[model samples]
Target: MRGMTNTLTIGERVAWYRRRRGMSQDVLAGLVGRTVDWLSKVENDRIELDRLSVIKNLADALDVALGDLIAEPSLMEWVADSGTKTIPRLSAALMDYRLITPVSSPSPIAEMPSLVSLAQEVDELWQAYQASRFGYVTTLLPETLSRCQTAVEAYDSDDQVQARRLLAFTYQLAATQMTKIGEVELAWIAADRGLAAARITGDPVAIGSLLRSVAHALLAAGRFREAMQLIQDTASYLDPHLSDPSPELLAVHGTLFLTGSMAAARANDTDTTRTFLKAADESAQRIGQDANHVWTAFGPTNVAIHRVATAGELGNVQVAMDLGPRIDTSALPMERRVRHALEVARAYSSWNRTDDALSTLLAAERIGPEQVRYHFLSRQLVLTWIKRQKGRPSSTLADLAHRLKVLD
Candidate 1:
């Protein structure tokens, strides 16, 4: 049944679960405030279930866990791809007693890492993540978390504040990486921890940057409204500082709007999406060029990339196809480049350009194998192509599916 469920599209999964619940299409449609015709089309995959809120509604009516409908990857699958104990160790690091409890005295332990050394480690982790080296990042994250926590505990005065800033950045990295791998709950916890650490540092730039992580976590968890609200409020708070903003502030602020645009698109709020994108574009224009300050990837080119993504999310396949393929993302991080390619592939698949979609996904896989394999969109699209094939799929398609483990 697990394998069967995985092989089914989301709409097919809904139909399967409805049958298991002994409910008719009419009955399920009524439960979800829709017509029987609408339900029939949904079950037939004639309609796309792209909105999270709608998906959540369907899951609620079906009385199944959200993941049961989404076919989220299992713990064993993640471990198989990411080496043994990666998820559990990261979870353990988040739950460490030392991090959670206040220490009265400095215990006998190895000397605390210097602030410079710790900062370098944090930067390295960010670099690994941006390169889509998910396995390596996960392997190194638990120890980095512990080391940063130790630095926070050992430093004093101004140094303590700096250590806290680094700790916040580390947590933000964990949160973002967890989201990419579909660990939404763990991502939420890490985002919250990063926000807490940023608060202690009293650095508006740090706090604002971590807020983007929090927003991403919320977006991953399907809390689209909460995510957008957080972004709006943070933007308002940071507006006064933009008169003569630091590069870090500009990048963080622009990235926040970009995230809000995505959340808006996911919620099917086209007006808000446009508004957020406009603000982000204006911010980027002020910055004048592509840059990765604060690891926000906030710049003109990045804004253009988000435009392609939001267009795809909003179901404007033409717009995505027009904008996505033309953008040269070589200057951006490998993670961002791969993500844009995935969006472009989605556009191609939507337009029924399956060969082009397959080729695009193959190219992205070559660039960021971990990103493509673990990403829900890539896996789903591959499964869909396989299901649509009348006989055997093409060799390259089959190999791609095998590598993604979607055929499992």
Candidate 2:
């Protein structure tokens, strides 16, 4: 501490600003509407803070002020905010670099990134997720969600209906991905938030989409009755009498009923399953020609995956296996495409085809460590069956079971 009021280098100032806001470089990027790499450079004094709007956005996102952000705060502030305080040895250098920036020569500025439109950024993130590039997905998704949430908070002030809709939809997307990792509770929370926001906007399409999300969470949690009720209620809300009801809206609602039916079958309530399926099929027909509506759930591929799960549950392994090969993998994102292999594993295991089952399971595991979920349940099922057949499973399967942490 020795210049002006105290000595703080460029790195020091950047680090201080980060601390002042109690943000990590990643979180700072989220606040400032920049990428992590860019924020890191800025903190290292390798980049300049050129965007006033971004700086203001950062303050808003961090719930802080621009001047306080310039104070000589310590990295401890960030640690405190992160709900932890032990400074990692690796992080020891950020402080030193911080103290050095004000007293030493400034680090050279990095080349600025080309500005991309918000939709373009979203498109890029979606593409990365589609590729199953988990590193990129996890890295950017938080920031994207932050931006969407921030936009949602400000949507009313801007008087933009479309922007509000986008914000609500983005939350639904976050909830869907959260459920992939078995965070069903959080996913449901997000869906509820989105539902409230959609209702505020009086957007039937948005509300229907959020309802489908809630339906997915309920269906997966084995709440068949509740899921059915939700779908039925959503149908009533949609008011099919609209002169040009969106095919996208109808398709999603139809898919919700299909999900409930599948859940019902899993519960062994065949009558309920049949009833829901009949309603779903009827609604599916009302969703006419537009196959690419982001909300429409109509592709033959979507139908195939649901068919496999339902048939497998109904003890019709042959039907599931038969439909498995007909699914169009090219039409789905990696997250859902990887689910096809899960269905394959189930169908093979059901037929007592040990080798085929193992192969499918291993293949799915190889491609989808970070992309898919619920493998532990499948592994447990196979291992239990194996143990029942013999005193123990094969050594190889036993080892696999251990790796998967299953009862087998």
Candidate 3:
């Protein structure tokens, strides 16, 4: 009991100094002179920590009273009040009603599902991670992944195409989460299956959507032209007259992923970009512009997040950042939230804002090790920008190359 108590106490102490310093794991590691990987292992209870001297150094660095390091309830408990605080926005039709909308559910958890319910099993998995329930999260992934796999297989045999499409989407969700948590190979395998199902089911939106992610995977490997080509193919494949897709489908394809082609356009035709944008907006309007499914139902906010960074390629960073948060992620079904978070991370990183870049990546990373792919994306942009800024090779860029075990 005492050992358990000590572990809790020490964890609390570690978490406190880290936060008080306003230091990310990487920054703290640099200060106290430890690798970020080691820092992560220590803080996450994956290692036996024995570096009180490091704490003293951190105390001096962050300008905190050293005594505060030993404060109780563990530092993790105060994260909400710590750096992740939500700054409430003023009301406007452009904002999420939830952002401006009063909290009608007195207890936030009132809407939450039990950890075992299928309807919200994906959320439960994410919740486990949010609560620092790493072991629980790990234990649950196989079950969730397996259950989703079984569902996909059953759909394969069943006559219901929509059920198959939904299950295939579920598989894609599981794969993307797995990728964020550092499950790259597994994620690729699952994603391939999901893509196959989308193809077999003839969901054009799903096909284009998978192609979009395929482009991301390619982009991360620095296969820029390949990624561009895939986007081109995807854009070529779309048929405006096609119907039955949710509003979110239009947003993702005609807007979100379509921006990739715009990025590679490089002054070919501003008029074409405008035309594509109009098509996306028109496609979204067909669905009433409601911000459901994480405001991805082709609403203004989702459109902003979708267009912002790519627009930045054409000098629209101010508009992108200003309009980004208005995206009502809360309205999204939980399965989609994880995916959106990864994209949000990418959007922020592309603007040369390292702090926002890291924050966005960490939001996805906090969820698990399988998300290395996103780290690749963010670090690529960040490293490139940093190198260009220095007029010398960035050591930080070199550091990420080492992490990726790739030499560029």
Candidate 1 lDDT by residue in tens digits, 68-126:
67776655244344677677888888876655666645445588788898899999889
TM-score for each predicted model, relative to the true structure: 0.93, 0.61, 0.45
Candidate 3's residue-wise lDDT over 7-90, tens digit each?
233334566567755678888778778788877766654443222234445555566533333221111111322232111110
Alpha-carbon runs more than 4 Å astray in model 3: 1-141, 151-163, 178-187, 235-252, 255-276, 293-297, 313-408
User: Over the stretch 362-393, how does candidate 2's per-residue lDDT look in tens digits?
Assistant: 76666664443233234334444444454667
- Candidate 1, which ten residues in sequence have the lowest lDDT sum? 73-82
Model 1 ranges off by over 4 Å: 1-5, 30-38, 45-54, 63-66, 76-83, 102-107
* Ranked candidates, highest lDDT first: 1, 2, 3
lDDT of 3 at 132: 37
**Cα-based lDDT at residue 395, candidate 2:** 74
Clash number for every model?
A: 0, 6, 16
TM-score: which candidate is best? 1
Query: lDDT per prediction?
Result: 0.85, 0.56, 0.47
